[model samples]
Target: MAPKVLIVLSSHDHFPANGKPTGWYLPEFAHPYHVLKDKAELVIASPKGGEAPLDPNSVEMFKNDPVSADFLQNSQELWKNTVKLADVLPKVNEFDAVFYVGGHGPMYDLHYDPTSLALIQSFSEAKKPVSAVCHGPTVFLRATSASGQPLLTNASAVTGFSNVEEDQAGLTSLMPYMLEDELVRVTGGQYVKADQPWGEKVVVSKTSNGAVLITGQNPASATGVGQEILKALGVN
Candidate 1:
């Protein structure tokens, strides 16, 4: 059988407070999907199980890129075919890895969904590679192991969308909370970002039992982050 990868996308279609349209970033999924589809069987799953939403801005920004163009061309086909997070939990063993594709929408939905948290813990407990990029790391906010400790408590290294980047984007005032602060202060995670905000940063950390975790900093880091995930999974 081909090695299988579970790609989790946010089901949300808007940002929380402002009610602004937002969803999964196209490049975050497209870049990695293009690389991994040939190497593994890619399964797109979402909280709601059917169609996942795409952030409007990302669609405009990446419309010209070849990979993103393909995603746009096939958006209807992709959205029509996602599986539920619940369905994936029972068959977690069938997957070689689980990857969380990121966007502002993830902060609104996956960040607080108990099922999403359970799914991440399931992959971790199974010793499978778990990969996330940008705000996709938001899914980890509520995940914990069977031992009762927070999943990221004092982890060697991790990176995600940063506070300064939020400020740089001039949307810090709009989000529910600062992601960088939550990772460090609330989750007991050691948050790391590039010297400058939004730079390509990836952190590959392993648990004592050999479970692998790979994280990327932001949208620009999406392609490199996906390559790192492929590497961690032993894909050529």
Candidate 2:
């Protein structure tokens, strides 16, 4: 059977800091979706269920990118008919992996959502791959293992939306906390980044217990993150 992957999206439609419109980033989801669509069975889900919003700025910024544009046109139903995250938590064993798609939106909701955190813990306990790209990794900021230890404590290396990238975007002050800084502090400097800002960077960290954590630095690293997930799942 094909590996089943749960694709988690943020249901938040706006940034709490300023009430500005924000949702999952287009390319972050689109690029990774295309990469895994052929090899895995994917189920879309979110915190609040129903239609998950897309970041308007990301849609506009990546409109010219063919893969993202095509996904926007053809994959609307996927995001629109999302299953409630809490409902899926009980069925965590049904999936082989869990992937978090990033946008500024997750920083508001999934960042602290207990249900989402629990699901990540479940996946980790099951030895299934837990992966995210860009701001999506923010959800891991609070996730813990079944043993009550910080989930990141086991990660030897990880990467996410970096402090430099956040500053470059000029939206650092608006975020509740800097992702890179917190990740570094949590993982004891396990956080990694690309050589330059906005460059593609994907890190695969395997915990001592054999749990896999795959992370990407930014939207540009989404595809690479997806590919790493497939490899982790033993998919050719």
Candidate 3:
């Protein structure tokens, strides 16, 4: 049997009434799903579970992308199969990897979620790959190693929605905190970026033990992020 990997998504759907858009981008979720579904047994989970919200902009674009449109057509079935975040009592030793999909929602929900933190730490402790992207890294802000050091601190390379991208999206003023800056500050890990907005792909940082932590800049990098995860899993 192929190794199983858990894919955690944010439960948040709507942005504040301020009219700013948020939630997981269609490509971010769909691209990874397409890649990993064939190679690993994937278990999707969310903080609140049951029908996670899809971003409106993402939905609009999904209609235009054949791959995404197909996924949406099967969304109901997908939701039915998803394991509730609370129900996923993940034993790091049992899974080969854990992937946290990002959106503005993660900044609001996953950042302080104890279960989410435990999942990441458990994966790290078990020497399994732990992957996240965009604002998904927010969860790491509070995750620490067994030694109490910040999990990503000086251990892995990381990236997220850059300050430049946040500013462009006009969310810099509304969000509770900046993700890119905080990741670098808290972990002292080197943060890199692509040259253009929404064009950055995945960057994988490997530990001496060969465990990999990979991150993508935004939705555009989702496919690449998924591919990196496959590579780390030793899949061709």
Candidate 4:
């Protein structure tokens, strides 16, 4: 049997401006899902049990690409069968890994969520690979390891959607807070950036205990992020 992997996505569906639909970026969820599904039994979950919003910009011709467009059309069916985060009775030992997929929505909903925080802590304590990409890292801002230390405090290597990308997307003024900067500040984690915004892939840092925490810079990094997670899990 393939290992089980839990994939968490944001539930928020409204963009600040005019209540436009926005949630997980299509590619971020699609690319990773395809890769992982090939080798694992993937479970999709969100804070709420319903349709996950897709960023409008991510559906544009340039952004949709082939794979993402296919995923978007099928996402509803996929999510309709997803396990709600509220309903997840994690054993912490049943799953091989956890991955957080992100869009601007996660910045608002998942960041301070108590349940999401608890899931991360539980998975980390169990020594499962804890992975995130794009704004997904926001979930870690409030998560703590089993030892009572902030999960990311002193975590030297980490990455996330950069301020530059937020600025370029014209959403810096709209978001409640800056994700990359705030994460670095609160956790005191040594945050790093790519040469250009949205151009780089995921970064994985192995803890001394062999647990892996991985992050991606933007949608461009989604596939690489999934690959890293598979590698960490020792899946082909």
Q: Number of the top candidate by lDDT?
A: 2
lDDT for each residue of candidate 1 in 125-204, tens digit (9 for 90 to 100): 88888889999988876777767667776467878899888898778888988888887874456778888877889888
- Pairs that clash in candidate 1: none
- For model 2, how does the per-residue alpha-carbon lDDT over 63-86 read when each residue is reduced to its tens digit? 999999999999899999999998
Global fold similarity of model 4 (TM-score):
0.92
lDDT of 1 at 48: 95
Q: Estimate each model's TM-score.
A: 0.94, 0.98, 0.90, 0.92
**Candidate 2 backbone collisions, by pair:** none
lDDT for model 4 comes to 0.81
Give the higher-lDDT candidate: 2 or 4: 2
Candidate 3, residues 126-217, lDDT tens digits: the string is 78888887787777778877667677766557788999989987778888888988877876757777889878667888533335788888
Backbone clashes, each candidate: 0, 0, 0, 0
Better TM-score candidate (1, 3): 1
Candidate 4 lDDT, tens digit per residue, 1-236?
A: 88899988888888675676778777888889888878998888888866666677777833538778777676567765666786774555778889999788888788988888888887887788998889988988788877777787756688889999999888887888898888789657578878988797678874333468888888888899999999988888
- Identify the candidate with maximal TM-score: 2
| Candidate 3 TM-score to native | 0.90
